[model samples]
Target: MKAILPGSAADTDKPVVLGEAAEPEPAADEAVVAVEAYSVNRGETFQLDGGLERRWAGWRPGKDVAGTVIRAAADGTGPAAGTRVVAHPPAYGWAERVAVPTASLAELPDSLDAVTAAALPLAGITALRLLRAAGPLAGRRVLLTGASGGVGHYLTELAAASGAEITAVTATAERGARLLPLGAVELITSVDEAQGPYDVVFESVGGASLPAALAQLASGGQLVWFGQASREPVALNFFDFFKGPNQARITHFDYTTSDTTYGQDLTALVRLVAAGRLHPEIGSVRDWSRTADIITDLRGRNIRGNAVLTVG
Candidate 1:
């Protein structure tokens, strides 16, 4: 087996060095996947920067994976060997092969390829949970900030399918145009000029945009804060909460939880992909050996959609 190793936070140049390692065998409750493809998330950069901490506390940098089960636990409660599946691995997913608990794996529909399936887990789950927290999306005037990235694209599609009228905010005209076919009812390049008073505001970009998003929400509306793309601190006014005639709700999303919800989310995503409701827009696909360059491209925000590394 081959894997990428990161020594420390300061060593940014090609942090993922390919090296041969022994193939992992599944534990009693684990399964070994022959990784076919994996998607990169923005948080991977934070992990590289030593900003985001990992559950396993090691520095291998891949998270969402779709692949075939090469070996399963003896109990057979997991996917059978040779079954195609996607999983939210315990650690971030940067590897040629991974050993994960069977609970993390979700069966992929025949219509969804490993590459696209790889794009679903983290981003898809976050979108589902965000929309659920926002309540029934039907007929709601929804505002999506930073609606051009991985999670943003999925959020847009999911919200649209639920019959929400979506207004998407992007940083550039080019990115804004990309959202037109993705079900964005309106595109606003400048947040300041955005006509809102939306029923729900999905805030993926934080910092100045957080307060801006909150301002756009209609009284009694809800705001779901998911990411901090700007990486800036957000300021809020306490008096605004009580002074407003209508009630307002603010919620933050965290996807780190039990494997059951993770599996359910991926399964729903696979079904959406099969039904032509969710199509993952991939910005770039690179060979496994070019992991460092992929991370650099992602960090620069030069890539759009979810970036996948084809391991095969």
Candidate 2:
């Protein structure tokens, strides 16, 4: 089968390619999915495109996948064989087929298609986890960064549904327009421009934006740091928090290490999609082999939302 592998290091323009690899076998508690499609993530681009050293240069490189289960878990845990499911592979998912833990598999309802289901796993799970980390969002003042992103879009809608007074931040006013109905009470181009005293901040963009978000936190507020799309390190003085007027709680959430149960969150997200309440903003639904172009565009922040790749 063909899988997406890291591009040649000597080449600067292209950053990914389709490479041939043997099919994988499922473990006792895992299922092998015949991948129909998958979504390209910003973090995946960062990890593959010369950002991290590659010992296995020609290995698979996708995180989310949706397809029919060709092989059921040996333990008889998850869905039976032939069940349509969406999964978040720990790594190496960009292949004709991939194996994922049964606990992380979510059965898709007949209402949802593979293209949309493929876009949900990583981004949806992250959004759900962030909301959980931030505590109850209802009746709270929330400020969200990267409002137009894949996770950002889901976060905005979910937070809004919780009755939080949301202030969304985007890079441009044009992109801010779509976020308004998604639960954003007010829209701004940057975190520094938002009103202070927010009860919670769903921060994904780090670097300069991190300091501005921290400064705006209300007393006893929680700042959930997830992704640093800015690709910049975050640093600040002790006085900014220890002696600051509003002492906010700063928390970091990593999906791989976070205590949030994968099956639980994934099931909830799938339900939302089936109910027509959750609309995944899918962009650039293209061939999987075009991954090189997708990587280049994501690193440039040119792709506004999640880019879905149809696999077969």
Candidate 3:
């Protein structure tokens, strides 16, 4: 089997190397999947940089995978061999084949192809969790920061489907416009212009945007913080935190530590995809051999929607 390994974090400009590794066998409760497609997440670069050193070992980097079940445990609790499925594993999904726990697999609907299913796991599950954390979105005023990114786009579509009024915040004019047709009722280039008092706020960009997002919450609003794309530290004033009319709650979703919760969220996401309520916007599709290029482009934030790599 072939996999990409991180050589040195110091050389961020250079691409990681692709090499051969032994193919893993399925455990008693696991399945070996012949990967057909996998998605490139923004966090892949951070993982390669040793940010997740405490959780994962080795350098194989990928989280979302869509494939066919090639081998299953003897108990047959997992999907049948040759069943199309997608999974969000805690680690090591960037290879020709991967061994994953049976519980992680979600059968891909016949209507959805491998590439699209590959694009759903991480981003879709994150969006589902955010929306659930915020409570019922029906007829509520919802504000989503970083609306142009993967999670943001899915959040926008899901919120809209629930009949929520959406105000999407993008960093650029073009990106803001790009989200309008994707269910964002209104688009703002900056958070300062957001018509506040929102019933719920989904904050994907941290740093200054965190505080700004908090300020827009309505009298009783909930805020879910998922991403730190801004690459800046968030600062909050104690007085504002205690005195704000709306009761604002901040929460972060780390999939590695919350597999049970993530699994449930993935199930809901698969249902949404199957029902045509959620569709991932794909930016680019690269071959599995071009793993380095995918990582490089993601680090630069040059790819759009969610990027996926097609494998055998």
Candidate 4:
């Protein structure tokens, strides 16, 4: 099989290169998926960068993938062989074939293509779980930051469908404009520009944005911190919480801890896509041979939404 590996540690550019991978040995509860397509994420690029002090010497970087099942789980826990599906592999999904746990794989509807299904795993699951954590969205004021990435696109649409009024924060006017059709009612350049007293806040751009978003929450409102895209630590004084919204709560969110499995959420997302309700904003698609260039585009923030690489 073929896969993507991080560039040489000495290389400052941190490019991803095509490489050979061992044939997958599926466990009793895992299926062997003949990967057709996979998506790139900003976090994976961050880990691929050699500048990071703690590097996994042979770590394979990939999370979301879609393909046909070549072999079903021996335990008969998931779909049978030949089923078309989207899967969240524990690792090494950037390959021609991958071993995916049954719990993390979902059969895709015939109406959904591999490219679109490939974009739904990580970002879509995270967005769905985040909304679940926030609870009841109907008639609520929901503020979302970093509202231009793949996760942002899904979160905006999902929250809006739940009847929540969404205020999306994006760095560029062009990027923000893309969210309007997805259901964001308001757009702003920064958290400082958001209208106050939001009922629920979905914040991902950490650093200064976290505190700013925190201050904007209404009393008893919930702020869910999901990512630190800015790569900066937050510094807050005790009095920062003493401001207007005294009872506001800031909760850290991680999708892995949620009660729902990846397959469960992926199934829901796939159904929505089949019914023309959810849209996967795939901004770029290229051959797997161009993985290096795709990583560069992701690192530079050039791709607007999800970037998919297909096996060829």
Tell me how candidate 3 scores on lDDT.
Answer: 0.79
| lDDT of each residue in 13-128, candidate 2, tens digit only | 86777878788877899899999999999887776755655446445577899999999989989999899999897777889999899988899898889999998988999888
Highest TM-score model number: 4
Candidate 3 vs candidate 4: the TM-score winner is: 4
What TM-scores do the predictions have?
0.93, 0.94, 0.92, 0.96
Question: How do the residues 59-102 of candidate 1 rate in per-residue lDDT, one tens digit apiece?
Answer: 47767998999888776778889899999886646677888777
All candidates: CA RMSD in angstroms?
Answer: 2.0, 1.8, 2.1, 1.6
Candidate 1 vs candidate 4, TM-score winner = 4
Q: Give the TM-score ranking, best first.
A: 4, 2, 1, 3
lDDT agreement of model 1 with the native: 0.81
lDDT of 4 by residue, 1-312 (tens): 678877775574647778887888888999999999999988887777743443455578889999999999999899999999999986789999999999998998888999999999999999999998999999999999999999999999999999999999999878878889989999999888888889998888889998899888888999999988777788776786776587888887888888889899889999998998899999999999888888888766788889999997
Compose the digit string of candidate 3's lDDT tens values, residues 1-312: 787666577777644677888888667888888888999887777766665462545647778999898997567777889888888776678888888888877887788888988998888887776776777889999888888778888989888888899999987767556577778889998889998889888887889998888988877677877788876789899898888855677766654454365546666778887887777888889887787777788777676678888976
Top candidate on lDDT is 4
Q: What residue runs in model 1 are displaced by over 4 Å at the alpha carbon?
A: 240-245, 257-260
The parts of candidate 3 lying over 4 Å away from their true place are 255-267
Model 4: residues with Cα > 4 Å off, grouped in runs:
50-57
Runs of candidate 2 with Cα error greater than 4 angstroms are 52-59, 258-260
